[model samples]
Structures are given as structure tokens and as C-alpha cells.
Target: MSREKLLEVQDLKQHFRTGKHSVVKAVDGITFDIYKGETFGLVGESGCGKSTTGRSIIRLYNATDGDVKFRGVSVHGKKSKDDLRIFNQKMQMIFQDPYASLNPRMTVMDIVAEGLDINNLAKTPKERQARVHELLETVGLSKEHANRYPHEFSGGQRQRIGIARALAVDPEFIIADEPISALDVSIQAQVVNLLKDLQDKHGYTYLFIAHDLSMVKYISDRIGVMYFGKMVEIAESDELYKNPLHPYTKSLLSAIPLPDPDYERTRRRVEYDPERDNDKSEEPVFREVKEGHWVLCTSKEFEQYKEDLVE
Candidate 1:
């Protein structure tokens, strides 16, 4: 593992056994590195294992195989209780669904203070209460709101509470799994901005998983595209948008709506014809298209990519 890397995920695979014979490969052999203080975006269609990857990285689900290293320590495999607890404190996850993630029975104070209490981060009740108030304020909520229940708040407020809960432990890395998806469109920007501001202020690393390409492009330093439980391409955000190489990536990029109606109507959509290309074969192959840019697919495409590079 590199010293600069905050979270190093190597060949991570998560499989679900579906009875006596069948299995669902939710995440298969995907590898990526998240450096400290950088937001690494994982974008894909729903049911493409974006959330699964996020969950697996945070140890919400034990990986079937592969290694997830936080700092220099391996988080997976057998470990002592103390070591695991330390790793848990260093990394935390913000779930996708704001409505279901929070406990309706618990007040906002209890919800945000739960992690701090579990980790023994505070010495006394007064100290914990103060910490909870500070966390709520950090996420743009007033201290008075802490007495209210989750049902009293709006979707965006609930999500902010979730963010505050994740931040309570002072985690170095966070898996933000579609943090703004459940909120109203008008409120989404506010949540995104809050996250960005938090990152800037606290120097937190994030694996921001979302299906929205534009949002991912806006928040991410680099992006990785996954399809059918496989990582098809990964590159710097600007380079990926400007020069997407994989057929799947091109198709995904084509789906993003343009601002002008006339240009939107005039622009041709890049259609991925599986029959015409036969690029979905079981055999996996990845080639380097440019510095720090990788594409996984067929040999012919790799050859064509090479020719294009030369030209």
C-alpha cells in the first residue's frame, strides 16, 4: 500500500449465495485507491453494485475475497477486537436512504450521539451533549433541533443529521452512499455543498457513490465506472468526461442531458450494440488508454485504442 493512500481496495469481491446453486456477484474483483483528502466517485446504474462496493469497504458486509486497507493496516481478515474497533473509528459510512437510516424512536440528539457514546469519545453526559450540539451545528442544524425526533425534520434535514452522525467519530474516511438522492432537487445542492465544505474544512476522504453523472463530475477528483459488477473504466474526472473510452462509458455519458434543448435534440446518442460488438464476453481484459486511464474490454478495441493513441 502506498503511504499517500488513505483507503486501498485491492481485488475486492462480494458474492451472495442465492440458495443451493446460484450466486449473485454484487461486486467482483474491483480495485481502486482513494488518497487522503480527495473525493473518489463511483458511478453506475442502480443494481450495478455501487452501493455494495461502498458497504463492503466500510465492513458493513464482509468481502468474500480481496483486501481493504485503511492507511497501512488491513481491515479485513482476522483481527483483534481492539484493532477492529480502532479501524471502525477511522472509517464510517453514510447510507443512501435518509428515511430508513435514522431511528424514528430516537431523538436527533441520541441519533447523532450514538457513535460518540459507543466509541467512548466523551467523558461525561454534559460533554456528550455538547459534542452532539456541535456536530448538529456543523451540519447546518440548530442545537434546539436536537430535542426533536427524526420525523419532525424534512428529508434534507434528516440527511444532514446522518452526515452529522457519521462525522461524530471524527473519521478520516467516509463512504457517502448517495447522500442526497432521497432529498428534493432544490435541497440536493445544499447537501452537496455542505459535504464539500466539510471536506475542505476537515480534510476528510470520501468514496462518493451515486448514479448521477453530473453530480459525480462536480464532486469527484477522479471517477470510476462500473457495469455488471465490473469496473469498466477509471480516470480523472475531466479526462473521463472529455475522452471516455469504453463503450459502456460512452453510452452512460451520452445519457446526461445537455442544457440547451436544441443541442440536446441535435446530439446523437452513442448506442451500445452488444450483438454488433460482442464486447461482453466473460473473459476480462484491461488496457491503458492514457496515463492513469484504464479501459476493460475486448482485444480488438485495445488494438484500435492503441492505433488511436499513435494517431
Candidate 2:
């Protein structure tokens, strides 16, 4: 709810009930602030609830508990239709599976123009067509491709169409939920670069969710690490990669493959042993290890980290 913050998520929780009354904690008490014009990356394993967190922020799924604030306004408490419409125009989402996100039957133009139609943003058919073409070109697609269906495009192209559709509404915030994961590895970079370019040009803020560490490092201004639906660590990109504090974070970073075979061979992998869970029971609570670097873990780890800092 700060003036400088574009989005503030406070202790967000999302739980799904199963048949036996068991609950899957998809997102559990995660909190973060995203400033305007910066990419805040959420990185974790596939089921760590990164995507669900993104969806919850955009109101795609209602949060079981907590608050999501946009520009000092609470999205969860908004009751006015005009306010909701303003929020919709300001926030947008790009889905993981491009093929499924886009309507297979709709023409590219219609797909891109759908937001404009729904929002009544354009006054005439010609204006809508122009807006669609502009969005297509912004995502590196041609205006001629507007008449084609989504199936006619490749995975990367389809993803571009998805980006265009999101862009059509002229949004200030975007939740890119694994935007390049489904595409070929070679094509992944292209999509990422395109997104970066668009962000740079428009000064857009993004909550980029991905399991790929290297890609997240490439696009994110800061990175947050999640484990079992909980955020364990968060820091600037370089700081997190170079000096991860949490045991889970260390383990996750250790798994990233190095390009040099010699380096890869010599690098020690951090093992996550359930037997070693005793570390969580001992002294410092979740405390700041350094400026802007936060770690949520056992008191012992915090004390040890603090000791290291003092030393």
C-alpha cells in the first residue's frame, strides 16, 4: 500500500480442498512488493505454486486469504465495477501454454482485438483493426498474419500472439507465467528478449514466474525462491545467485548446470536430507541477512548467518 509500490502482496494464501478434507496449500503465506518498471521473478519447481500465485494476483483465482494491492488499492476488496475495469486494464496475464491460451477458432486479429472489444476501447471496426495490427507488430508479428488461426502458427509465434493479446489492453503490469517453457529451447530466448524489449520500451512492471533459474536471472531485476508453496528467500538477482542463504535455496542453485565440464564436475551438489531437518529447530527467526536480502528458515541458520556477518 505504499505510493512507490505498484503491487503489494501480503501473506497470500490459496488452499484447495480434497475428498478426505485434506488441503493442498498451493500458495502459503507468501508476501512481496513489486515496484513499477521492474521485473520481479518467482522461481521454484513446477508444483511450488508459482503459477497459482500469479493467477491469484491477477484475480484469475480468488485467494483463500491475504491481500493483493495494486497502486495502493486493494484488489480483493474492490466493489465498484469501474474500479474492477480499471484494474483489469492495468493488469494482464500471459499463460504458460500458448496453444491452449489462445482460442483455436478465432483469427489472430480477433484474438488480439478481443480485449479492445470487451473493454469498448475502440470506437470503430477500423480503429480496432489498427489496434490489433499495432499489437501484432509490437510482438514481432506481421499484420498479414491477422487473418490466420492460432494453429497455423508455430509455438513461438503462438506465444507472440498471446503476448499481443495481453498487450492489446495497454496494461502496465503483466504476469508472465512460464511464458517460454513450452517453446523450443532455441525459441525461448527470442520470446524472453521480446518481452524485455517491450518492458524497456513501455516501462512495464512484470511478475515473471518460471522454474528456469538461468532464464529468470536473465530477465529479473530481483529473484524470489519458493519451496513447498512457501517463499524461502528473496534478493537481488546477483546477490541471490552468489550468496543464497536458505538451505533449500542453496540446493536449488546447486542443481543449475554449468557450461564448463571441469567446473560442473568439481561443483558440489547440496543434498536435501530429511534427517538433517534439525537445523530448523534451533535459534534466529526469518531475518534480513543483508540489505534487501531475506531468508525464512530455522533460528539456528539465522544465528549462524548472523555470526558469519559479524565475523
Candidate 3:
């Protein structure tokens, strides 16, 4: 991973007002950075605000507070048409549900070419057709598949269409929000491998959001564990897996199933009891307990984590 920062998210909050008196904090005060040419994985259970973080960063939903900077420019607040256009071109998103994300009415060719059309990336129909064909092949699809509608393809194929659309504009960064979760288990690895291959070919930076820790660990250079709309741990992927410091992270890691039946039978499951672990005296803060590992903890818990690392 490159040391140059590609994206910076500082204290991002996304809240929804359900009623006149009720509010939901979908994403509350989270911060992280994605470096150029690295895949930063965001993992948590469903509804843990991982998806919301990706959407808010891409401006799909207006952030209620904090800042998201791409390169050096702030993505929040009002901006000129040119600025918005630039932002859209530089950042793209692949939605979670491939079945719902694609327009069933449009042909695959039109779907993939939409971004190219909007950005005027291709000047002529011939150029557009060539670009669409190139993208289809890049994502392991054929030129013949382009004429078919979304309903004609399977879930994995539909996701490839989504990926083609995202790459049509040649974006520098992509936010993949559970792109493989909707596919069959057999197909999931195919899609994930395709993404890794693409990233390898084109030095693209990624904010890969998903609930599958095993899959995330496979593709990510760094990983951040989220809980209840807050980041509980952040570290290099292997480091986080080998030495999990946060209770929630340990609970999450312990839940990953192995192929060995013997190991599965013997594996110790650690249930996360927030009531027992949380210190209500003071709210815990995100602090670095080691050179690159960070965890949300109070001073007392921080000391304990440090001693645990030593031992």
C-alpha cells in the first residue's frame, strides 16, 4: 500500500429523522483513511453502519456532520457543477444488491455505458461500443451479453454489470458495499477474485464494505472493525486477525468457521456482552494501543490491552 492518502473520513455522522421526535444514528463519529492503491476493508454485522459510511463518503446520502476529503478536496457541502462532476468521475460505488441495483429495463450495454455517456468519455458511438466491450471483457463477460437485459443474467453476471458500470468512467477509487454477499457461495469467490484482479491490474483504491470477515481479510491490506456505529478496532489485516485487541473484534474473529471439523468442534466462541464490557463511567475513546493497532477503550482498558500485548 502506498503511503499517500487517497481519502480521509473524519468524525463522519449520518443520522435519519424517522419521526418528529425520533432519530437514528446510522453512522456516528467514525474516522479512517484509505491510502492510494490499497483496499481498506470495513467489516461488521449487518446494520452496523458500514454501508452508511460508504454511502455517506460517496455523497449518496448527505452527511449530518464531519468531513470526507478525497485527495485534498472536501466532498461535503455545496459545490459548483464542475466540482460535483469531478467528484462523481473520481469516486464510484457498486451497491450491495445486484438484483436491485441494475435497471431491469436497460440492456447491459446501455447500463455499462451510462457513466461513459454522462462523462462524455467516448465521443462517438463506435468509441462507446468499443469501451463497453472492453469493460465487459475486463469483468469476465462477453460482448454478446451486452444486448441482454439485467433479468436475463444471473446474480453474479448482474454484479459484473455493476462493476463494468463503475469502471466505465475509469474511476480512481471504488466503494464496494457488499458486492459479493448477494451471490451464491460458489459465485462469491469468483466475484471477490475478479475484484482483486481488477485492483491489481489498475492501481485502484477501494473502500470494501462487507460483513464477511474471511472474505474481507482475503482482499484487504488493512481492516477496520465496526460496532454499533463506532469503530472498535483498526489495524493491518493480518495483525488484526492474529492479535485482536477489542472484545467485539475477538468475538467477530472467533465466529469465522474453518474447514476442519475437528477445529470447528473445539473452537471457543466468545460472545460479546456489551453490558459487561462497557464502562459506563466514561465514554471510551479510539486510541492506538500499539504501532498500528487502534481500539476503542478507556484508560484502564487501554492499559490492560497494552499489558496483554506484552504478555
Using lDDT as the measure, which candidate wins? 3
TM-score to true structure, per model: 0.94, 0.94, 0.98
Q: Write the per-residue lDDT of candidate 2 for residues 30-127, one digit (tens) a residue.
A: 88899999999999888999999999999988999999998888888547887788889999999999999999989999999988988999999999
lDDT string for model 3 (1-311, tens) is: 43999999999999999999999999999999999999999999998999999999999999999999999889999999988988999999999999799988899999999999888999999999999999999999999998999999999999999999999999999999999988899999999999999999999999999999999999999999999899999999999988898999989999999999999989999999999977777789999999888999999899889988832
- What TM-score number comes out for model 2? 0.94
Q: Ten consecutive residues with minimal summed lDDT in candidate 3?
A: 302-311
The global Cα lDDT (0 to 1) of model 1 is 0.89
As for lDDT, the candidate ahead, 1 or 3, is 3
The clash numbers for all candidates, in the given order, read: 0, 3, 0
> Which residue pairs collide in model 3, if any?
none
What is each predicted model's overall lDDT from 0 to 1?
0.89, 0.89, 0.94
Stretches of candidate 3 above 4 Å error?
none
Name the best candidate (by TM-score): 3
Deviating ranges (above 4 Å) for candidate 1: 1-3, 278-282, 307-311
lDDT of 1 at 126: 97
